[model samples]
Target chain A: MDLNIAVLAGDGIGPEVTQQAIKTLNAIGEVYNHNFTFKDAVVGAAAIDQTGDPLPEKTLKVCLETDAVLFGAIGDPKYDNDPSAKVRPEQGLLKLRKSLGLFTNIRPIKAYPTLIDKSPLKEDRINGTDLTIYRELTGGIYFGEKKLNEEGTVASDLCEYSDFEIERIAHLAFKAARARKKKLTLVDKANVLETSRLWRKVVTKIGESYPDITLDFLFVDNAAMQMILNPNQFDVILTENMFGDIISDEGSVIGGSIGLLASASVGEDHSMFEPIHGSFPQAKGKDIANPIASILSAAMLLEHFKLYEEAKAIHNAVEKALELKVVTTDLDPSSKYTTTKVGDFIADYIANSE
Target chain B: MDLNIAVLAGDGIGPEVTQQAIKTLNAIGEVYNHNFTFKDAVVGAAAIDQTGDPLPEKTLKVCLETDAVLFGAIGDPKYDNDPSAKVRPEQGLLKLRKSLGLFTNIRPIKAYPTLIDKSPLKEDRINGTDLTIYRELTGGIYFGEKKLNEEGTVASDLCEYSDFEIERIAHLAFKAARARKKKLTLVDKANVLETSRLWRKVVTKIGESYPDITLDFLFVDNAAMQMILNPNQFDVILTENMFGDIISDEGSVIGGSIGLLASASVGEDHSMFEPIHGSFPQAKGKDIANPIASILSAAMLLEHFKLYEEAKAIHNAVEKALELKVVTTDLDPSSKYTTTKVGDFIADYIANSE
Candidate 1:
């Protein structure tokens, strides 16, 4: 099989960490005897500095022509602190998502056995906790019509959801639940918001088709508490955009380190995989940033194309690295392993391991 | 001082737990040489069962005539499970808030040294966690205009905020911060929502007036993650209705059992105190429900009336109860203490302790 991938190594530590992902992917390509080609494009603050546009036409073109896009972290302190700047680095990624029509964001939160001690939660609370969140990305309050009164005294944002929007994500979430624990919990404020009631109505109708998968409902506030009190009880969580953004970030902490979590944003036609963490501007060119999330993102890219064995191989390598303590400073402060060294270890293990 | 109090012990374990709070308040009255009068009113499912209205006119009249309302719990499985039911038990509380014009909901989350083991988080993470959340209750999406298309294909809820709405709550929160740690963190989605940006602008202006208080900002998503990763960093968290609803509930878990948390809803002219936990239908009449939260609500009621010394005595007595293992089954499963027993112990200690 031949795969063409687009690499958007954005800014700060993004380039450094993304290099490790490319190295590990190359290792997988070698081991699986798959032909792979990659094209690099600038984005985020780096693109703004060079082309005066965060998401350049060339970058979008490259992403469109590829089998999948491998995204690194984006953002820089310079752009983040500037309130006056109109074209921000984050808009680049948002535009890319809109262009690609990526409406569903998949985040898998797992408490690894070896990393339990690293978590803020007690061992028993987070033990054996593995859940994936299917977040509807393009709709909801964030993209709704915003209004500010002429007096500057009042401001509003409309949170809107259509049946078509809810149905598309519900099918994906139900399918993912069918493949995993056969359970899905839809988190919404059905008692208060009309949109949430619609979510329940449409999702319940979708649940009828997948009779084998059990469906449950939890209010968003209760869902937030349950994420901390009993994370293990959840299998697959489905929610609208804002609730997803909040809980997914909350769930990222349950895994002990944000540096180890990866996410995938996919639509009907295009897909993009990226790390959950942002570009650590302070760690730029320091070779001390964690590369595992980026490497795992490459694994997700493989899985998007139905390369199960290749993806499993990458997962096995990651587990081995964790077991051997081949991690960056975030996981083990005393360890001297650099960012590239950790990536090299994982790549080497993938190539040689039986 | 003479005080007239309204008690609305609505449903399930509400009556039993509220009885303990009354007993404790009576003890405080005896020790402080104060005249106290109590009026009983019905709300929630109990009110619905009797008058077919959750918050009857008589109950609102009783509340209006009282110094403050001491609420227990609301909700029942009957109204909760029946989606077709036009009236809900929760509506009683919402209506009461609107009638009383209670715009600010205050919840203080603290990790007791003795009960640290009950928390899901590691000991070090929650050891000294003490934070108060001032939530703007009467506004935001919950009260916003909701719309559903004629075809039932689309649903939307508008989240609107005015400077006046933001200012009233901001002043209360800033005052609370000044009394506590003199640090305030305003949580909002300023990067996205127009309402949030308005919040930032208004709060930033209000913050300048209180120059002694160190004010900061965090996006709602990152704030959710930070609540778990580093809870101790927060002093006073001020947010809008929905963000507060999510984070305050999330913050509740850090102190171990939700049974130990109390909250206060205050307006300019009226105030109400209640336990943050819901009515547990399973624990109704079982004599096993924890009464500490209700008792603490009574303490907050005392504080609202400027009876700090009386409030301190109650706090000391409750702390002693936890220290002596006189807690109910929720805190200690094998202690063999009933709800009334724990309440009796707290009341006795408050009355007799020097």
Candidate 2:
């Protein structure tokens, strides 16, 4: 098997985590008789500083050429504090997503029994909680037309979504649901927004194709509430871009640390995998950032290719590390392991166990 | 002082719980030297059944003339399940909010130490949890224009917000923060949505007026996740309409039963007080409804009038009933009190003690 991978080691701790994921991937390659080629690309603030474009033409070209892209973190405090700055790091990420045609963001939230104590929810409420989120990445308010008033006192952002956008993502969610728990919970504000109504109508109809998948609808507001109250009741939660953005963040809490969560954004020709956690600018050089999420993202990449055994190996490596208390400070505050050490431990575990 | 309170007992446990609130309100009237008038108004499914209107014109007239409106619950399974039904019950509530100019929906989530075990969250998480949500009712997507495709293949809803809408609601949130812990967190999807950017721009400006209050912003998604991870970090959360709907519902989990929380929808002209819990259509006419939330709504009504003593009296009565183990089945199965019986206990406690 030959794999072409685009590596975007974004700003802050992104490079640090990406290095660990690369090490894990290399170990997987050694164990499995696979040939792999990698291309490094600049993105976010780094790309902006170098090419004056967060997502340079070369970076997009590299991403397009690769089968899957492994992304590190992005964003910098320099851009975050300077709200007046026109070219921000986040713009690069949004642009990269649009350019790559990565429209569906799949975030899996599962509570690990070993880390249940870390969660604020009760054991009963959080235990046995496993759910996936299908977030429409490229549409809704994210891509909507924005306006600022002449007086500057008022600003408006149009949250417009065509039926076409909603249906495409709805189809993905239903398809995923049909394969998994056979339940799809559509989260939208149908009572208020035209887009949500379109979302409900389109998704409700699409759901009919997968008869085994029970369809239910929740107003985005109510869905947020339900996420906390009874997260276990959900199997697959399908939502639009904006709603997905918030709910996905909220869903990550079930796993104890958002740092431990990984997400995948897949389109027709390309796929991108990354940790859901943001670049902690403070942890850029500290060597304390968690690398498990990035490593797990590599696992997801393998799973996407139907490499279930390879994917399970990576997941098991993480689960094993947690079980043995050989984790970064985020998981084991008393441990002396650094980011590099945690990554090394997981890779060694994978290699040795194999 | 005399208060003519119009009671809108919509459907399900609406009549049952409103009966409790009324009894509690009337009991306070005797001790506070306030004459009280309780006029019953039909709304929701009950009204749709009787007058072919969820909120009849006569009912709106009564509400217009009242000092305050205390509502129970609304909606029924029949109306809830059949989404195609033309004269839905929730329409009346939405119309009532728009007509009454009820822009602010205030929900207070406080964990009762005695009932911590009953909460879905861990005891430690719930013990000191106290959150208040000021949800904007008449703006954003819920009220936005909805469109359906010609072929029924697509559905869409527009989510728009004006400068005025954002400003007024932000001011209310800031004011509430000032009275609480001097911290305000604004939740929005500024990373993607233009409406969110408008929200941040306005709220950030409004924040300047209150230098004493520490204002912060979070994407709605992250806010949802954080609400579960470390709810103790928040003081006051201000967000747009759709975000509020979800956050408030998730927030209610801190208090255990949804039936234990009350909400106040306030405007310049009139205000409506009701339980935050939705109408449990299945519980209608069952006498098994928990009236605590409705009773607490009565407490909120008194507080709105700045009748601190009157409000305290009702709150104390409620506390004593809980202390004595005289509560509805939802609270404690040992007592097994009916909705009216629990209401009577609180009313009796207030009348006897005061």
Candidate 3:
């Protein structure tokens, strides 16, 4: 097998962590007799500093030509402080998503047995809790028309959903449910919002095609509570963009550390994988930032490509690292491991795996 | 002191819990040597069942004539099953809020010392966690104009907010912050939504008047994470209606059970107090419903009237009840106390308080 992977090391600790991911990916390729080519491109604040644009056309073209993109974290304190700035690093990522036609965001939230005590949630409640959220990225309130009256007193943002938009994501969610668990929970405020009602109608109609899966509904408020109360009860959660953003971040805490969460954004033709954690500017170049999220993201990229055995190798190594306490300061504050050490350990573990 | 109160025991465990809250309130009146008159009125499913109206004119009249309304949960299994029902128990509550000008909703999330271990969060993370959410109830996307395209392909809900709406809630939150921890955190998505930006601008401007209190900002997603990460860092959380509905419910789980949470809706001239938990129709008539939420709601009602010592009496009694394990099945699955028995104990405790 051969793969052309574009690496967009965005900013801050992105390059350091993504270097580890690349190291791990190369190790996997070596172990499996796969040819993997890595091409580097600048993005986020680093791109802004170099090309005066957060996302350069050359970088996007590199990404489009590649089989899959391994994205590092983006944003910088420089842009974050200046609200009046015309160009921002986050804009690059958002525009890249739109340009690449990436519409569905897949976030896998699982409570690892080794790190269960790290979570704020009781071990009993969080243990065995494994769920993935399929959030529609391109539609809903985030991208809708916003307005402010001339008086500047009233401001409004439209929350719009089309059957076409809902159908596309609903199919992906249902298909994912079929692959993993046979249950899907649609979280929406159906009784109140017209868009949510449409979502229910379309999802229910589409659900008919997936006869093997059971579907259920929970109001957004109740769903939020259920996420904390009994996270183990959920298998796959399907929701709109805004709800997804909120719930996925809430689900991030179930693992106790944001460093362990990995996410993948997919379209019909193109897909990109990245760590859910943002650029930790303070930890940049310090060799202290956790690389597990980035490495896990590479695993997701493998899973996206249907390379199950290869992806499993990466995950197995990660679990082994956690069990052996070969982690960054975030997971084990007293551990004397650097970012590269943990990544090297995982990559070595992957190479050494039968 | 003399007071007239409207009692609306809505549906399911509503009537049962309200009975206990009323018993405790009456006991407070006796202990404080105050003349308190209780006027009973029908609302929610009970009102819809008997008068064919969820909020009868008679009920509104009684509520308008009273100092404050003590409400229980609403909704019925019947209404929940039929989505096409013209009148819902919740409509009455919504209409009641509008009619009474109850624009500000106050939800206090406090983890009890005795029940701290009951929370999904570890004791260290959840102990001494006390925060209040001041949500603007009647505005934002929930009540905004909703539209659907002719082909039923697209749907939109407007999320509109004004300086006036933001200011009204801001003052209350700031005043509460001044009285409590002298810190106010405004949670909104200013970077994305125009309404949230308006909220930040209005709240920031209004915050100038309170030099003694500190004001901060957190995007809704980050706020959701921080709520679980460090709930004790928050004093007063101010957010829009939908965000409030979501975050407050998320905050509820930090305290272990929904049955322990109580809320208040207040405006310039009128106020209404109720438990945050909804009608559990399955638990109706089972003698297993928790009355502490409703009883604590009575304490909030007393506090609303500046009856400090009287409210303290009710809170102290309820705390003693929990400390002694004299709680309903929700708090303790193997508890010997029934709903009425727990209420009786609280009322008796209130009667015996100094």
Per-candidate RMSD vs. true structure? 1.3, 2.4, 1.6
Better of 1 and 3 by lDDT: 1
Any runs in candidate 3 off by more than 4 Å, and if so which? none
Ranking by TM-score: 1, 3, 2
lDDT of 3 by residue, A250-270 (tens): 889977778988999999889
Q: What DockQ do the predictions score, one after another?
A: 0.94, 0.61, 0.85
lDDT by residue (tens digit), candidate 2, A5-40: 999999999999989999998888889877777899
Q: Which TM-score value belongs to model 2?
A: 0.94
Off by over 4 Å in 2: A149-156, B78-84, B149-155, B204-212
Clashing pairs in 1: none
Fnat: each model in turn: 0.96, 0.73, 0.86
Number of the candidate with higher DockQ, 2 or 3: 3
CAPRI class assigned to model 1: high
Error of 2 at A257 (Å): 1.4
Task: Please provide, for model 2 over B54-103, each residue's C-alpha lDDT reduced to its tens digit, 9 standing for 90 to 100.
Answer: 99999999999998999877888887889688999998998898888999
TM-score of chain A of each: 0.98, 0.94, 0.98
Models 1 onward score TM values of 0.98, 0.94, 0.97
C-alpha lDDT values of all predictions: 0.95, 0.84, 0.92
**Over 4 Å off, model 1:** none
Which model scores highest in lDDT? 1
First chain TM-score, candidate 2: 0.94
Instruction: List model 1 lDDT by residue over A201-281, tens digit each.
Output: 999999999999999999999999999999999999999999999999999998798899999999998999999989999
Between prediction 1 and prediction 3, the one with superior TM-score is: 1
